[model samples]
Each structure stands twice: as structure tokens, then as C-alpha cells.
Target chain A: MKQAVEELRRQAAGLLKEERVKCVIGWTQGTDVARAVPFFATSVRQAARLTWTPFCVNNLSKYLLNHRYDNTPLAVVVKGCDSRGINRLVQDRQFVRERVVVLGLPCGGMLDREKVLRVVDPGAALQEVEDRGSEYMLRTDKGEYGFEKREALLSKCLECEHNIPVVSDLMIGPQVPSPAGSGIDRFAGVRELETRDPAVRSTFWDRHFARCLRCYACRNVCPACNCKECSFEQAVPGWQQGACWLSKRNHPGQNYLFHLIRMFHVAGRCIDCGECARVCPVNIPLRELYRKVMKDAEELFAMKTPGTDPEEVPLLSTYRTDDPEEFS
Target chain B: MLVSRLLEYVGLEPGRFEMRWISASEGGKVAETVREMTERIRKLGPNRKMRDER
Candidate 1:
């Protein structure tokens, strides 16, 4: 892991020094040990601060949208899951492949900060992290803490299928085995919800949606949500006579409409990066909602997972002669 | 079909939503489809799931 961090910094510095890219987006040490925040390195000195650890959880590809119109080339660091966001942007034609560099990392898994805090001191300063195949050994200024991968890894990581990035210009480190077991079912949660009665499911979703603050954190972090102008944002020129689709007042009906519309819009294009659920302040099980759409798409259209293949057309954008029309 | 499935997943009764194909020339078929959907929805009663009660 240390070697990978050193190599990451070296490559980032080289890219900046040679003027290969205007900036390199990576993670730097955050204020605490359990968090690694996104950092943009434009100079060699800034690149040296780049680091890699189990805490590097944010998907950096969405930041590419910021440079879309500038025409300035950029380099981005991606873990297995984050790499799909790049394919999503490129496939959407929102970004050009030639204008950016992809630095790939083979991720073992990322720690759930809340879970880690239970075992490690809140203020502990991390010195090093060692992956022991089954668990992570964290060396902190306070003490050493060992966390088993199954218990500490984020729920998304336990079922990850892309530990090694599908696309990359350069591989950063030796491949690490995926933490997901062979028989793990990624759609189990969605399936469970499907088996419930209609009223039960309604109550279940309402319990979560009612607490939503409508902050749009999920939309902002999503790479699949690459709209130039979101309908949720007010002051559009010609939408519903310039009125916002949903009122700013956070009513239950409006919230439900907000989530459902967003889900439908991203139905076939969602990369299943789990960023929505991760960033949700109210702890909504948003991945389950998105996966229900994915599962239905697969069962109905025999579609593959979105953003997995860069060359594949979006699910809803194209149709086949044999497409199911049972409802009609 | 996808929207119907999504609505069902979010707890709306399957009968509350429907889709049918009726060309412009098939005015009788359109009325028949609407009649069938209206009867099914009547049996299902009011859609109170996503309704704003406030």
C-alpha cells in the first residue's frame, strides 16, 4: 500500500512536471485518520501530498464535469468502483477521452468510518495501513487496530465486482483480491423489498423519504447525473413555464416525486457506484431503489449493467425488435 | 412497462397504473381501454400512497 502511494505521488508529479495534464485529481490526508478528501494537484509540490488508503472512498470522476468546457487536460485517480464514472461520462459524450488521463488503482475495500471509529480512537492520527488479505491493520498514533474486511468494509465493497478498474491509462499497484465472496447476491436487498406487500413497501420508503432534506447531495455527487441544467434547479428558461418541477417546500408527495423522477431519469445509465446512498445524510437505502430498476431492466430487456462497457449504447436510448411489450 | 414496475416497487397498486396502445383511428379501442383501466382503478380505491396530506 505504501509503495502504491509513493508511485501515485511520483506519477502525479511526473504528469504535472511534464505538463502532461493541467491538474491531477487524487486524495490527500484529511483532518482525521478515517477520512481522505479529494485534492487537486496542479504543481509538483501539491502532487507529493497525494496519498492512498482504505479511506479514499469518494468517486473523483464527477469532478471531470468541472473541466468539461475549459478544454484543459486533466488526470484523475480512480479505484475500481470510481472508474465506472469515467465510462459513464465518456459514454454520455459529456467528456472526451483524449482530454484526460486515467490512473487506476486496484482497491481491496474501503472502511466504513463510523464502524472504524467504534474500534479506533476518534482523534487517532493514522500513520500506516497494511492489508492482510482478510483484514486491515491500522497503525495509528494512539495504537494499532485490526479490522476484519467483512465487518469494517463499506456494504458496497463487500459485493463489489470491479476491484480492478475496467479502464485505465496506467495501473498504479499490484492487484488485490476482491473482498466479495463468490456467492454474494448484490440484489438481495431489492428482492426483499419486492416481496413485501404494496402498502408495506409504501410505508417503508415513506419512512426514509420523509426525512429527506432535499439537499441534492446525491445528485451533485452522481457521475451519471451529468445534466447541464437539472430540472430540480430553479430558473430554467422553458420548463413548466419556468416554474420548478417540484416546489421548494419539502412535502412528502414532492419528495417522492423528486426521487422517482431522478430514478427514472437515470434508470439505464446508473453505474451502481452507491454514491447516492453513501452521501445521503438521512441514510436512505438509495442503492436498493436504483438496483430495482437495474434488475427490472435486466429481466425485461436482458440488459447488461450500465457503464460496464464503454462501447455499449444506453439501455433506454436504443431498442431491439424483440423488446418486450407485454404491457402494451 | 418500466414505469409501472417502478410504481409497483414503490408501493403503488399495480391496477392504479396501466398502458395500452390505441391508434388515432381506433377510437372505440381507446374508449374500451380507458373503461377497463377506470374500472380496475375504481376497485383499487383512492391512491393515498404518494398523496400530499398536508
Candidate 2:
């Protein structure tokens, strides 16, 4: 990991000094090695803060879509799953591929915070963690402990195939072999619900949507949900005005519709990077919504999204005259 | 409305297509649109056949 950081430091400094990129977005130590936060380095000095480790789970490309700074080409460090998002944006023609320079980092797998929290006490002030081959050595205020890498790994890591990155302009580190099926069965919960009657399904969704805060964190973190004006915020006939907040009967069925419509809109385009699920404060099974859509696209249209060339017309935007509609 | 208006402006030959607006307020419009569109599609024939002849 240190070797990768040293190599990235050199490359990032060069990109900044040459003004090739307006900024370089990468993870940096946040108070501790266990809490790496996204750092945007505009200068060579800032590049020194850039580091990589198992704890870097947040998809940094989402910061790029936010346009938090002035619109300029950015140099971003992307893992395999993160690269899929870049591919999706390009495939959807939402962003020009030329604007970003992706530094593909071959990740063995990232630590899932949920999994880590399950093992370590939530209040434990973790200071540093050393990657010791098979086990990670940790230093916390409570005490010191060593944990197997497998135990702390994110659920997504269990099925990761793109740990070394499928696409990047400059690659660093020797490629590591990723697992065959990193738990990509994103629709397990949804399929379970599908077996139930309509009333049962309605009750299931009612319980989940009943807890929604309407914070829009799910939509905000979504890579494919880059709309100028979201439909949920509209007034005058207001599709989802009264139903956004978390209250009984206030949310109504529109909350479910809002989710359904959004999922369908990005059906073939979802990269399944887990950003929507990660960002949901209320912890709704949002991944299940899009995962079902993705499964349908793969089965019915034989379409794989975002990772392909930009010229291929998306399934939603294009249709066939001889399309199989006889079943209807 | 957009579909009908566009087809009208283009001056398409009669029976080339049919268009309708199915509002959320109207439940029957859903079935009506589906039936009407199906009829128009049948009249126009299969799209692949039309493309091949052209």
C-alpha cells in the first residue's frame, strides 16, 4: 500500500504541476488510517496527504458529479467498482469521458464499515491499522487487536472481480485476483418479496417507506441520477410533495412510485456500486430496487450497462420494430 | 399530445400512426391508448417489414 501511495504521489504532483488536471481527488488519512476521507489536491504539498488503504470505501467519483468546485477536468483515483460508475456516466452520455483522467487502483477489497463496526466497538477510537499480509493489526484507545482481513471486508468485496480496476489511464500495483462472485445477487430481498401476494407486498413496502426521511441522500449519491431538477421537488400537481417526509399516510404510495420511477429510469444504466445503499440514512433496501431492474435488463434485453463503449444506444433510448411483444 | 402534434406537423400519410394522451386522472384512457396503439401498429404492419420494403 505504501508503494502504491509513493507512486500515486509522484503521478498526482506531475498532473497538478503540468496543470493537466484542475484537481486530483483521492483518499487521505482522516485523523486516523482507519478513517480515510476523500482529499482534493490542487498543489504538490496537498498531494503528500494522499494515501490508500483498506478503509477507502467511499466512491470518490461521486464528488466529481457534485461539481462542488468550478467545472474543470479532474484526476481521480478509482477502484474497480468506481470505474464502473465512470463507464456508466460515459455510456449514458451524461459526462464526456475526455474530461476525467482515471487513476485505476487495483484494490484487493475494501473494508465494509458495517462489518468493521460489527466486530469493533463503535465508540473505539481507532488510531492506526497495519495491513500484515493475512491480518490487519489495529491500535485503538481501548486496546490493540489483530483481525483477519476476511472478517473486516465489505459485503461487496466478497464478490469483487474488478479489484485491480477494469479501466484506467495509468495503472499502479500488480493486479490481484478478485473473487468470482462478490455477492452481486443484489436482488435477494426483492425476490423474497416477489413471492408474496400484492397485499403482502404492499404491507412490506409500507413498513420500509414509512421510515423514509425524504433527505434525498439515496438520489444524491446515485451516479446515474444526475438530473438538473429532480421530479420529487416539484410543486403544482406535485408528484411527491406531501409524501416525502416520514409520517404515517403522509408518505402514501408516491414514495414507492418515486423510487420505482427512478429505478426504471436507470434500469439498464445502474453499475451496482452500492452508493445508493451506502448513502441512505434510513437504510432502505434501495439497491434491491435497481438490482431487480438490472436483472430484468440483463435477462430481457441482454444488456450490460455503463462499462461498454459510448456509441452503443442504451436500451431505454432505443427500441426494435421486431421487439418480442407477442406475449402481451 | 406531443406525439399527435408532431405527427400532425410532419403531415404524415393517413393511418401511418395513431397517438393519444392517457392522463393519470383517467383510468379507461390506459386501456384505450393500448388498444388504439395496437390497431395503428397492426395497420402500419411490422416495422421490420416496412423497413425492408423501403
Best by TM-score: 1
Docking class of 1: medium
Residues A13-57, candidate 1: write the lDDT tens digits.
999999999999999999888999999999999999999999999
Scored against the native two-chain complex, candidate 2 gets a DockQ of: 0.03
Give fnat (model 2). 0.00
| Model 2, span A74-101: residue lDDT tens | 8989988888777766765565677888
DockQ of 1: 0.58
Q: On residues B1-54, what C-alpha lDDT tens digit does candidate 2 reach at each position?
A: 222221222222334445445568988878877777778878866632112110
Please give, as one word, the docking class of candidate 2.
Answer: incorrect
Model 2 earns a TM-score of 0.73
Q: Count the backbone clashes (under 3 Å) in each candidate.
A: 0, 6
Best by lDDT: 1
